[model samples]
Target: MTNWYKSWEEFHTSLSKHQNQTHQLFRLRSSTSVSQRNKQEVHVYAWMTSQESGQGPANDFVQQVDTTRGSISRFGTKNVGTHNHSLGRRQFDNHPSNRRIDEPGLVELVRDLSSACSKAKLIMQHLRLKSGQYAQKQSLYVYAPIIAHTQSYLILGKQATLRDVHNLVAKLKAMRNGSASVEERLKARLREFCTQSGNTATVFIDDAKTAQTITLQSQQMRRFFKAFPEVMLVDATHNTNDAMFKLFSFMVHDVYRHGQYVQHSLMENESEECLRDAISAFKEFNPTWEETKVIIIGKDFGELALLEREFSQAKSFVPFSCKKKYLRTEMTKREYGGTNSLNTKRAEDSIDMMLKATTLDEYTIGLKCLFYLLDNVKLRAEDPVPHPKHTFLQYFMRNWGSCRQLWAAFGRAGIPHLGNNRRARDFMGYLKDILKSTMGLDECVDTLIFLQSVLRT
Candidate 1:
């Protein structure tokens, strides 16, 4: 008996020899036969030779085993029958011979199972590829549309950034060539694809001259006043050069809905004609001037007569005494050297402080200064004889004098007025905060909605 275990090399050598050899047979017989009634039977047989049998060596040997065993004692016949049965069973289990017994069905089953596993693997691979491609495609789709629709222009004679365009082209190239070389043939193919897809290969350069002309035309002074029918606040400050004219603008409270229209033009001289022209231009822009209302808020009566003549059909000319209105009312009454005296220097100083108050902290400091000035004014007003030399100091003592009366006058007429710089600054600060915190257009809309809700409440 040989050991069943062998190394792969040793097993291969043994298997190779077994395949080349003719068929091998072994026989076994029982010790007793039923016919002889417990008598032992001995059987002798000779296997046939291939040359004499005229059959192949392997077939002759197999047939000889069957004949010899079958002709022996009954015990030998039984042994031969069992061997024959095993041989027939093997005919359905082994290779070519087993192929006859629904072999195609077995082959197909194996092929089908292999095919199913292969298809499943392929599907998983395809899904992974598609997921990656989809992400890439999505990014390209988003940015490409923006680039295609982007309005390009040159500023200071320099071209605008083309980073988006370059990025798009790079992404398109990457999509076409995953791991392949970027050959001329591939480029030609890409060009053809772009053309078919309505994507132009040429980059159109924006004309600087044309862009400038368009921008100027777009920015031309147009009638935005119709949309906001309220008092226009007119004030002027000379710039460092003092050559060119620039007017500072502010809208009165009612100007947002309906009120007086005010305008300013910085002339070499504060002439009546310059004022008239400014008022005329304003009225021209306000075509509904016949239907609409007008109120002019000026620092003084500088252009009052001209405005009245220009807008004769409109309401009364309301003179806004910045000194009396803002300085006195906003600064506690005691600050203006008593409510009786209107001092110019103190008013100027208060206005300067208000202008300097840029931040919230600075604004609080200015208010504190105003409080101190108001207290000083009250002390002076109580004096038996107010010091004439303290005229500069007395202006601060008056607390803006009759400015409060002006505010009341407008208020009675259902007109809105931002009485002082502090109030204007506060409103501006609120607007700034709203703009800074807003995320985007949607957020801005949400903020407006929230404001509307708050107003309703």
Candidate 2:
């Protein structure tokens, strides 16, 4: 319920009631409280409970908080007592569903959902659109009813509120994903999908065993996996599905210069064995999987080392981001003037900025500037010219200088994307939204195939 204030003084007085409260999030805005307040006021958006924000009874919540003596915490007790008793429980509008079009919540819903629907992912979470019909709005009327039922409002007309749209989407997902047991529903869907899509998907599930893995690959992915087996990015993301299994993404770029997700695997963990089994399955899907030489890039050497064995000709590269981090860290040593002049922070920033340079000319200019700073510091002290023996330059040269081709933009042969955990992390945020990625085995399949479908178009 939203509480309102007539003037700043009133609002301040009410807020002061929670003076000793901490870590409570608050959002305030000017709202037309129409059917509720029908007066000029500021509103506090909150679910009414024992405490203003459900923090609980405060030890020292008075205007003049006394912490010296062991003061009894009676602050939230008043709210708690008030919350428990039904006397004047009208704090919540029992029949708020009868509110008019000008109601505060409905108004807020309309305002927020309009902006949210502009984004495809958000709209998908909030709407009930079927596959291939994501863009089509055949029955806006159907979505409106979802709002009416959830909010207890009789939606009379064609005009739909943002709240209605979002609720409808949620309702649709609950239905489409179905209420079948996680395993049974998933197995059925997997069977139907494999039959329909002409794609290859594999699942490993065992009640007796602790961990499971599911892998999905499309026809486009199959072709790319077989033809140009070069440059695969391997990374795992967590918490995108219902189960807490790690969602590992195997990515490669196709001839068309687009970043393609060739395989999606859900594993119990990122263990070397799990990864090895997952990668080996690529060959199972197509015997010619490792027919061509491959280049594998990843953050984990444990996994990459195993790939070396499977594909002998496969070259391994570290993500450029990881290499940059290592350089930045190594320079932050005490000998490098940790926080003294020629500081590590500045050195690290310079190196990072220089590495991101896309062209050789830009990189050369950046390198010149970097050496000028490092060299100047050395000459100013008349210190023996910097050498590889003790300085960061030595470690850098030995570890990464010669390998610039593996991490620098100019060195990449038109490869547009690097396989990094960041990409998977970002996608997980969008996939999970407020719900888990997969609820069961079937839900896991649905989630991966949905991702594959999105990537396809």
List runs of model 2 lying over 4 Å from the truth: 1-90, 94-179, 205-207, 291-296, 300-302, 325-441
Tens digit of per-residue lDDT, candidate 1, span 342-414? 4445645655554444443443344344444534533332233233234434453353322323322422254
Colliding residue pairs in candidate 2: 126-169, 127-169, 186-442, 240-437, 241-437, 241-438, 242-437, 242-438
**Residue 233 CA displacement from its true place in model 1, Å:** 1.9
Which consecutive 10 residues in model 2 have the weakest lDDT in total?
128-137
True-vs-predicted CA distance for residue 436, candidate 1, Å: 28
How many pairs of residues in model 2 come into backbone collision? 8
Tens digits of per-residue lDDT, candidate 2, 84-134, equal: 323222322222342223334433444455423244344434332231132
lDDT of each: 0.37, 0.58
Query: How many clashing residue pairs appear in each of the predictions shown?
Result: 22, 8
Best by lDDT: 2
